[model samples]
Target: MIITTAGRSPSKLVMKAKKLSTSYGLSYKERGGVSIESLKEQYQDDIVVVGKERLYIAPLYDESNLFFHPNLAMIRAKRMFKGDEDPLISTAKLTEGMSFLDCTLGLASDSIITSIAVGSSGSVMGVEGNPLLYLLAKEGLSSFSSGNHLFDQAMRRIEVFHSDHLSLLQQTKSDSFDVVYFDPMFHSTIDSSSGMNSIRGQAVKSELTKEVIKEAMRVARERVVLKDHWKSDRFAQFGFTQHKRKTSLFHYGTIELN
Candidate 1:
């Protein structure tokens, strides 16, 4: 894949793009008044455009640009501050000083919320298999500001990695985190949000296996959680106790270790 700056790019943004290309070992292409479409056709590869606000990945086929956005995390955070409980927090039994491992870090919306629930005393790490998606989430989590100090801090606090979840889980020590969580790609489209659609094409699509659950169980001190469609059989297949939420398209399942 090649990295380039947005149209009419400033020198600073160009420098940033070049730096990212070196850091990630991607080719740096001078914009030269070429459109993303032309760039894709010429290079026959995915293009990462470093914009002023976010890094957009323009696929060779898909018209939608995949970039990082807080998505629903910002809303959930506001509700949490208003004394409303977040479903994931409730399902994970998260507290202020807990640590969370997010195996599937799509755009990191859940990770941001998990970070908030864990607070400064807590730890949150997320892993994404897609390199471009990882870069997008990593950059956004580090620099994206919501103008709310607490929310911004939550986004920034997350530790992100570009690796397969199972590999990371295998490397983790037993009881390493309080909660180990997985939110794999849904079997069916639950929400067709533009952001989700953008990620769906590039995000890793892997089924959770018994080995993964075993590794997660071994690594988690408190519990192992799975977030999937309400109708998914994974809860039963993975020995997770389904925590069904009425009127919700998805539900959380947990295997409490303690």
Candidate 2:
């Protein structure tokens, strides 16, 4: 069954969402269109489709929660690094004093994870183009830090902005970051029918493109890591040399930049 709340207000959108949930015989709650209980209920044993213009599915039982599903970053990271550590936690070899510019913040999971990895001395600057995702990410971060020490510390170490990747990168000086991380969404070959649907992922994939990589490279100080699919030629066409490659259970790819 398909339910659409396209071009609806927040309150009305929630109403439509609720109607769909009830029709599906699933328990649900509405809190400004960010429903945790409802998601947990619907995704418990099945997949759920959400949003209108940019659609996404959520798997109720995924280990990383619906937001930070392994299918998102983990696969991309593994494909980029070849067989390295956890992509969310270990995509880049972060140092305590280094500053990073995440060209594509997406859901801000990588930024939050990177902030923790970098510790107190390091800083992470993240840019997200989509207003909705940026707002959602900001809200999530704010909520995550409510009276939490780790959240407070992580929030302090990270700076998020709502802007296009290229525009933001143009504003930064050359060599600003020790590492500029680019995870621009390449067209995925994985069937959405079997994987968790991420709202932010779908929006990001639809909006991000290869030109963002060129901008990322221009501003990176030491290196630029472009995440791509194993079969994608975006890296090669862009003249990037492969620095690392990794494979995983679901996907494969390389990490390369000059």
Candidate 3:
């Protein structure tokens, strides 16, 4: 992928884009009063736009540019801080000073919440298989501010990595984390939205298999949690006790180690 600046490029942004291009091994091209469409056609590859605030990746095929945003995490975090119980946090049985691992980080919506639940003394690590998604999440977690101190602190504390979940789990020592979580993309269509649509094209849509669970079990000390479509057979297939929500399309399931 090639990197370029936005239509209005300041020196700082231009320098930042060049630095990112060098770091990510991408080509840095001058915007030069050119349209993204023309650039994409010329390069025949996705373009990364380094805007004043955030970095955006415009896929060659899709118009929905993928960027980093906290999305629902900010809302969920506010509710959680206000004493609302979150299903995933409850399912994982998170505490103030525990370690959590998110296998499928995606946009890191879940990881951010887990970080808030775990607090400052605790730890949160997320592994994203997709490189672009990893870069976006890693940078966003550090830079984005939610205007709420608790939520902003949680977002900044997360450690994001680019790796396959199973690979990371295999490399991890036994019982390395208090909780391990997965929220793989649903095989069956659950809902439709532009955000989800943009992610679908860029995110790693890997199957959650038995082997992955085996490694997760070894890595997690307290429990392994999964969030999936309510109708998914994975809960039954992998021995995760379903925590069904009557009104929600998705459910949280868990395999408690202790």
Best by TM-score: 1
lDDT of 1 at 256: 94
Candidate 3 residue runs with Cα over 4 Å from true position: 186-199
Instruction: Give the per-residue Cα lDDT of candidate 3 at 89.
Output: 88
| RMSD per model, one decimal | 1.9, 10.2, 2.1
Q: What TM-score would candidate 2 get against the native?
A: 0.55
List, residue by residue over 1-258, the lDDT tens digit for candidate 2: 223232333665567566756744444443335454354565454333345333333444443323222234333443433635555344456656777787777666567656756778888888877544554455445444335465456755678788888788878887778778766652243224233233434344434456666666667766666565555566577655544445532222233343
Expressed as tens digits, the lDDT of each residue in 1-258 for candidate 1 is 899999999999999999999988899999999999999999988899998877888876778776666757887889999999999999999999999999988778889999999999999999999887788889889988789999999888899999998889999899999999999863233245454465467666666999999999999999999998889999999899999889898899999998
Q: Over the stretch 1-258, how does candidate 3's per-residue lDDT look in tens digits? A: 889999979999999999988877889999999999999999988888999878888877777787877868877887997899988888888999999999988778899999999999999999989777777888889898778898889999999888988888889999999999998862223124453465467656567999999999999999999998899999999999999899988898999998
Candidate 3 TM-score, C-alpha based: 0.94
- The count of backbone overlaps in candidate 3 is 0
lDDT of each: 0.87, 0.54, 0.86
Instruction: List the candidate 2 regions with Cα displacement exceeding 4 Å.
Output: 1-84, 87-91, 145-152, 186-211, 243-246, 249-258
- Evaluate model 1: give its TM-score: 0.95
| Model 3, global lDDT | 0.86
Ranking by lDDT: 1, 3, 2
Residue 241's lDDT within candidate 3 is: 95
